[model samples]
Target chain A: MKIIVCVKRVVDTETRVKVAADGRSIDLGGVQFIMAPYDEMAVEKAIQLRDAAGTGSVTVVTVGPAAATKELRTALAMGADDAVHAVVEARMGPNATAEALKQVIDGREYDLILCGKQATDEDDAAVGPLLAAALGLPCVAFVHGLTVDGRTAIAEREVDGETERLDVDLPAVITAQKGLAEARYPGLKGIMAAKKKPLETVACDATGGKTELRSLELPPARAAMVKIEPTAAGMQSLLTALRNDKKVL
Target chain B: MAKYEAPDFFDLDSLLTEEERMVRDAVRDWVSDRFMPVVEKAYSEGYFPKDLIPELAELGVLGGNLDYADFPRLGPVAYGLVMQELERGDSGLRSFVSVQGALVMFPIWRYGSDEQKARWLPALHSGEAVGCFGLTEPDHGSDPGGMETKAVRDGDGFVLNGAKMWITNGNMAQVAVVWAKLDGVIHGFVVPTDAPGFTVREQRGKHSLRASVTSELIFQDVRLPASAILPGAKGLGGPLSCLNQARYGIAWGVVGAAMAVYDEVRQYGLTRIQFGKPIASFQLYQAKLVESLTEITKAQLMNLRMGRLKEAGGVTPYHVSMAKRNACHHALEIARTGRDMLGANGVAGEYQTMRHMCNLESVKTYEGTHDIHTLILGRQITGLDAFGAA
Candidate 1:
């Protein structure tokens, strides 16, 4: 089985985000970037399936500027066989990004494709479905568990507090969820070996996203927490406040 | 807590190779993710988290810079970066790797016979077997050439006798690279810890480097096969060479400790309120932060230069001693300053400043004492040996 895992580079989840001066994007100064968390799960799952099959390759593809190669190197260090750098200089939306990935995967030989349910930065959650639609392949979203047997792939997802199992034929796309697979830390050996791995950079012309981002703003600041006493009179006062002042009783 | 941003006041990252930065980042992340959560508890409980051995081996840190099969032959700078990152988490963690890679595995690779290498290198690399360097005897630390550990030729084998003290990984080691005198000359011997007459005693009640294992090793007429001797090791230079390797690592390792403490205190000062504002706004605190950052930056440059010189093969033991001495002193002082900067919170277990301060005490004293390195450099500069007098 040949697999292609799509990844995105986004600001680390722990970063203290600041809106850029442009008012439509985030400030990148001093910001650290990581392969999107869920996308790590996708890369891990691809490596796992390839290993279990004992004979296959995992090709990680990403659409971003040259700096995104750091994330690509991270994926390769996590055991991807090779990587493809679809060099898209500008920041594009999900539709355009998906279109670039599709252009890259147009003639690739892959039995499966994997992507995170969404990139954490924008959280669009639209790339996987969009790519699958473009390729006319079956797409399963929010997959937590997956297994491949012969020509069939079984995926498990949580829907409405219920477990839903879907069976898809070969050559499908799956969006990885939290429980899909746990990413491994790139070992020193892997980091060194990744330098020697095959990474082909291709200039991509895919641009002009379907949607444009509007002015962004930070959320309103939260109020300081209020401490409540445990005494009976305090409890009565709290009830009064909740019912009268806060009106949440 | 604010995410740790390593002090790169000098932009040292620009001086490092891409691979060096990548390897350093990988180790840093592993320490942040797997080691940090358990470090405080491990230190308080006085145990070196043995569970991390497999992970360390899997990461290929054990004997990583060696020519052993499948091991990455990382350059001196890369290896030093690994030490720096590990020590940033805790000195004990870095000590574990330094002893394994530089002290124990290095000798076996550099001097042991083919059989010895085939037998122990892979096991040590995989961390299936633990090893310790046994040169600092109870009576001979700085002057290991005066060691009393002796080996007598006994019919196609040797009988070893003596005790080694302050042995890191001693109690847990399956093998020890023991330096002993034979025919009035020093030689390196690979002794199995499980051999009859060989004994290990744990040293308890350590206030410094509490997260690491320190023990005493005793060899009472321990019989060893003729093959146990490292074939290429003839004199004190063999063990001294190993010390040089570890000291080189130490020079880089303490910078990590310094960076960790500096980062912690800088973050603390920025948010810590005093006199109606962040203490960082005060001149006193700013001076402290600047002093610490300045020293750390100097140490980083020195370490990188030393590493490059080592890789170029022009580095002498004197250079190694100077780097080790200066870096250790600066880092220890930085840790103490950081601890003091934290004030009451410094002594609290939640913060890492005090832990680093305590661990650095051991780091400064080990390999070569700060004073010993001073004398070594002093002797080199003045062409006079002040180590002894008539």
Candidate 2:
């Protein structure tokens, strides 16, 4: 069982993002980058599957600039057998990123492709499905639990207020959800071994996509709260304000 | 529910390699999750969390730098960062690793015969067998050459009689690296704790580093085979070299303790209001924070350069002495100031500042005292023997 896990490098969620001077993107200066949180789940799941089977390889791939190798190395440190970096000088949309990934995976004999349900920065849950369509393979989205046996795989996905279980065959793409697996911290041995592991980089040709960014701006600041007493008179005033002004009472 | 935000004012993260960062993150996460939850309680209760030893071993922190065939070899910088992260959780935790790695396993790796190495290194690395270095005796702390422990050859074995004081992990260790005089010359012996006439007594009522195990080891007519002596070491140079290794780790470990305290106080000052405004707005509080940050940054650079030198070889004891003295002194001062910034809350163990403050007191005194290191540096520069008579 050969598995390919797709990861992304994103600004740490703890960071306070600022709009770039161009008004169309985020400022990258002094920002700390980390492996996308959700993608960590995908990488962890791939490693776990390989470990449980006792005979398989887990390969991690990322689509970004050359600096993205840091995230790839992090995955490798977490027990990925090898890594591939599809180098793109500039940021690309989900479709273009998927196409780059398609090029990287074209010649690989992979039984499974794992990815995060959505990238934290973009929040567009389209890459996995798009890549699956491009590769002509079935896709299981938002997988929370998964088990594989022979050529068949069983996955548990969380739908809108419901749990859906699906049976997908081999050569499938699975997008990991938050509950899929808890990512393991790489031990000292793994960190040392990762330095010697195989990491290949391939330059990707980005064919422009349909989506275009218009502008990026910070959200409006929230108004300060108006404290109200629990007394009947205070409650009556609050109700009157909500009914007349806010119109939600 | 306090969060840990590592202080990297100088963009120091850029100086570390990806592998180093991974190792740091792993140890940092483990310390936060496993050590932090119970550290205050353990300190207050005056008990070491022995349960975490297996997990710590699983993380490969014990003898982390030793090139054991079973474990991947980590560079000196990565190993130093591991010590830093452990100290961030608590100084006692860091001391445990320092004593186990630098003082115990390091001597065996550098001085033990092949058979001795094959017998002890693997078990020590796995934490299956705890080991302690016995050099600081009851009468000798700074001057180990004055130790009275004696080992006399008797046919195929040696009979040892002596006592070691302030020995970390002494009571819990299964094996001890005991330094004793053999034929009027100091030598190291691998003495098992369970040997005949061997006794260990735990030191009680410690105000500093209370979370660690401190004990006294006594060896009365304890016999060991001829092979027990470390063949590669002779006279006082053997144990002194081990102390040097431990001191290098101490230099890096104190920085972690200082960072933890500085981070805590900075957050407390910003949120703690006095006279209707946060104290951080005042110049007095800012001065303390600035001093701590400056000292921590300087210590960090010193440790990084020292780590590189150690890895490249040709690192002298005086070089380690400077770093150890500087880092420990600054860390003690930072912890005290951090405690002061906490006001009444500083006295509370719940805040973690006072605990670190007390722990830093032990760190400043152990491995090598701040004054001792200063004299070492002073002698290195002045070419004077001020240590014996001044």
Q: Residue B234 in candidate 2 has what lDDT?
A: 94
Q: Report the C-alpha lDDT of model 2 over A60-97, residue by residue, as the tens digit.
A: 99989888888888898889999999888687889998
Task: Return the top candidate by TM-score.
Answer: 1
Whole-model lDDT, model 2: 0.90
Per-candidate DockQ values are 0.72, 0.64
Please count the clashing residue pairs in each candidate, in the order shown.
0, 0
Where does model 1 sit among the CAPRI classes?
medium
Q: Candidate 2: misplaced stretches above 4 Å?
A: A159-163, A229-249
Judge the docking of candidate 2 as incorrect, acceptable, medium or high: medium
Task: Give a tens-digit lDDT track for model 1, residues A152-208.
Answer: 899999999999999999899999999999999888888888999999998776774
- For residue A76, give model 2's deviation from the true position in Å: 1.5
